[model samples]
Target: MMWREKEQVLMFTFTFVIYAVCTIILFNIMYRTQPTPYMDEIFHIPQTQSYCKGNFTKWDPKITTPPGLYLSTVGVLVPLAQWLGWEVCEVYFLRLTNVFFVFGNFYLLYCLLLNLHPQISESKLLLSCLNLSIFPLTYFFVFLYYTDVGNLFFFLLMYTFHLQGQDLVAALFGVMAVFFRQTSIIWVFFVSMAAESSVYITMKRTKLEKKSSSLQFLKKFISTTAALPVHHKKQFVNVLIDILDTCGGYLLTAVGFIVFLYRNKGFALGDKDAHVLCFNVSQVCYFLGFVLVFCSPFLLSPGKVKKFISFCIKEWVLTAAVTAVMILVLEYLVQIHPYLLADNRHLTFYVWQRFLGRNSLLSCAFIPVYIFSGWTVLQTLQHKDSVWQLLYILCLVLSVVPQKLLEFRYFIIPYVLFRLNIQVNSYIQLFLEFSIYVFVNAFTLVLFLNKPFYWEGQSEIQRIMW
Candidate 1:
């Protein structure tokens, strides 16, 4: 057993090392020229400089993200650069901090995959590791001097803990990730329910397996139905007990009941459960925190029943929900605490416009990337017959809508979640795997080419005969 554990660790470490090296090389190629980092990067450097100069007051507002990365930036890199007689203004060193975090992100992803798919064989594990290395958009964000790098790491870390049945740890990590980028908080809503649902599925399967040998149990229900006598033979009480044996199973059973019945569409037993009151309470807490931003008021106010009806019946309910939340949050913040908008702004369309307009070529390139990405996630969720897939779809819609309303940066975390969703078939699996490799390498090559990376001669290409 000890030897087996060591072997697993060795494999994980080996995979991590290879992936990290390849990622760093790709990033080095991409950011070689211009080297102009984002404004947020510049903002952080000044904060760190203030801290190093024994001035901590101005640093407080900039500490929206956790102190872990900031401390390292100030204590290690800033000091080293100063000692080497180098100017602190060099953006390369600040970007270098993200280089290291990218590996840490990979490690977290590996650990999360392991936790979620522990039953997978060694060969599949290696394949999954390679999958991480070749993930298409990972290169773009992983090497940037942006909070997304750190947020992605902690996001996966919390997800890993959730997969391991550590909900509290997952919640904490998720909260931290959202603090770095508040829009990511919506993911916490979906993931928590999904994790709970997954847990329930596992437990139900286990109980069914444990009871498989019992034949007499079917005799009682034989009179009620023919083909599924065994299914009908069981009482709701007995099934409920089996579900109650584990928290996850109970939620799943409830979700099944709520989702399957047309009258209860979008409702799950888990949603109705008193125990889930705690989760709702957590949402309320998040709403309150962002209250100055507008979300809290809408949730608190018993808005007109017509709006709720519209939200429910809308074809794009997920999109509508996100927009409504954005309006609610933004309006409240503007009204009550306009001062917050003076310095640290919240939920503006400015970010989205900048991403698409400023990064037009790369944004266009990302279209195929996201298409393949959405295709993969949809295929995966469609593989299962359970109502949970509907919830997953809603979540996907919610993820995309924010990018439409606010900024393209909002799409980053959602896109990551979509990609991380498993593939339902070999076709999707192979396509994603191949696309990640080809796109990353191609993007790198494009950046390295002497000419501009923009399209030059699409109409001039000749088709080769098969």
Candidate 2:
């Protein structure tokens, strides 16, 4: 048994090393092809360079993100650069730093997958790792000086510690995640739920040994209530109570988030106009559409789709209530920054303005899509039926729905988590997924490398707007 375990470890190591080498080569190719600063790097690179110069107090006014990334660079590369007396190519060094984190992110993801599904085959594990490394939006960030990769790393670390039952360590990593990217504060609830789920599962399993009557009663009650007519007041109340019991942590987290925003003087930072929340139903559709596209591989199975639809039908009231609440929250209550809408160079902006006519009809048209997204999320929760998984899905939905800006990169962690939770059983399915993944990344990379655009009258820049 030990030998078999050793063999598995050796195989995983060999596969990871190969993927890492290929990723490094790909990064180098992209770097050589387009070495200039692009997108947010316009601010990220310059700020990091300032850090290299020992101007710790200096910050780029245009960079809204916290100084974690810059401070990290200063802590690591500044010393190395000083030791080597090399002051040039600071941007490249920063990108290199991201490259290191990129590798770390991949490894941590692999560890996470293993912890989540210990019975997974080596071949399947390798495929999962490859899928993450080549995930279109995430792959693009590897060659840039962005905090996205680091955010993913810390987020995965939090999950890793959670899986190991190290709740405090996981919370610490969750704090790191939030510091790196303020949006990551959602993980506080996610981590809390995960720990709570672990306890719940353990207690339930222990109770199973004694055939606890409460467990039996709860199960029978749920099954009975699920079968009752929707118009039944008792049934409705029971279902509502069940949902609240399951989701109470999320409600508490929401309150904490409000407190956080109050303390921070509002959720928007740096460019306040660029990140506010507002009633933007189209943004929710856009993000959900992205989720569908990203997860099309898993959704392709007829059985899975049928299962998801059945789950929605089974819990129609819960599903409808959640979906309605989501839409209402997004439309009337949320604040929107509309960063993508502000940038005219991207496809999303034109889609909203020109194709969609910026009308309510467009929002109404995507109602089914929104319902489908909600169903998919609920299906994920039901499959796991764990407090942590439910909380994670809630947090993910909350994070994206309120944003007026739509970016594929924002969905990275959720995408990874979703993919991990899904089971891909067929080689044909795997091949199709790999094909789509490669095609998407290749197309995006080529478009990013060759497309010409101007930002603020700076001519001939090759950058992806989102």
Candidate 3:
């Protein structure tokens, strides 16, 4: 046992070292290729630099996000920048802050996998870490001064602590995640739900085990109180009490988020026009396509998918009703908000215009795509009835549905959560997934570095390019 434990440690060390080295190489390539600020960094870098100079009150009027990123730099990196006496390098130093957080995220993820699945082999754990490293945005964001990585790091930390049953610590991290990015409230909700659900499931299972016979268990499963003995009723009441206790931390965190939002003036600070709550069917289709692309490897087994669909078919009517209601509600909500209907500057807007030729009729073609996407999410939820699984699917769908704007970066957390839920059984599958990630990363990196003709007339080129 001792020898095996040592071997496991060595394997993990080797895998992590390789990940760090490759990440450094990629970061360097991206930094050297385009050292200047790109896209959002145009606002981010200046705002962060202001923080470095101890000007907390002066924020860039154009930058809408919270000051979490800048504040974090001022707290840690600013002192280092002063020590190095590097003027121009300060910006690069700020960008490099994410590099450390990237490594921190990897370490947290490794720890999380261990805690969540102690039975997992060291080799498999290493492969999982590698899978995380290859996630395009993981490397891509490291090159820019963005809140995505920082928020992700805290999000993972929240999950890691939650799995360890440190509820208060988990809640604290959740609050930090929201501070980094407003959308991270989704994670707070997920963590809370996961904790509550886990407690309920465990208590329910224990109570079921105490029942005298299989028939009683079946009866309890079919109907909550039907045929349940008097003793089980007392146990059910106790389970509800336990669930409330377990959820205290999450409730505290939720309150904190509400307070923070209230103090900050609203949920987000950026140009509200850039993102509106609008019902865009095509955007939903694009989001589905995005998920399919990122999660293609796990979704490869048609047999498993068919089985999930077959199981869900029994509730087909209910599912259809819920989906239709959700779509209609979202459509109605979109018009109630003041949002830009058309922004050619956004990549999604540009693509739709080019392919659909600005014709409203072409939009109808995406109806089937939206249906398939909704079914895919429903199937995933049916496949795993765990609290975490349900929350993951809900957050993934919710994050995309209300947004008028679309960006690949928006899906990073969802992708990470999805990948965590999947069990990669073979080296071949891991290799295939890794290869696809690398190809996509390379393709996107090239486009970002060498602005192609298609990128012309885009706001990104005008504002972000050096």
> Which portions of model 1 miss their true places by more than 4 Å?
1-7, 26-40, 51-56, 59-90, 197-379, 383-388, 404-409, 423-435, 448-466
TM-score list, all predictions: 0.52, 0.78, 0.78
Q: Tally clashing residue pairs in candidate 2.
A: 7
What lDDT tens digits, residue by residue, belong to model 1 across residues 107-161?
A: 6666665665566665465665566545444545555566767667767876777
Model 3 over residues 334-434: C-alpha lDDT tens digits?
23112123443334445545543344445445444455555665455444444445456567667766665556567778778766766656777777778
Clashing pairs counted in every model:
8, 7, 1
Better of 1 and 3 by lDDT: 3
Deviation in Å, model 2, residue 71 alpha carbon? 1.6
* CA displacement after TM-score superposition, residue 96 of candidate 1 (Å): 2.3
lDDT tens digits, residue span 103-174, model 2: 887788788888877777877877777787677777777888888888888888878877786666776777
lDDT of each structure? 0.48, 0.68, 0.67
Runs of candidate 3 exceeding 4 Å displacement = 82-89, 196-247, 276-285, 302-351, 354-383, 452-466
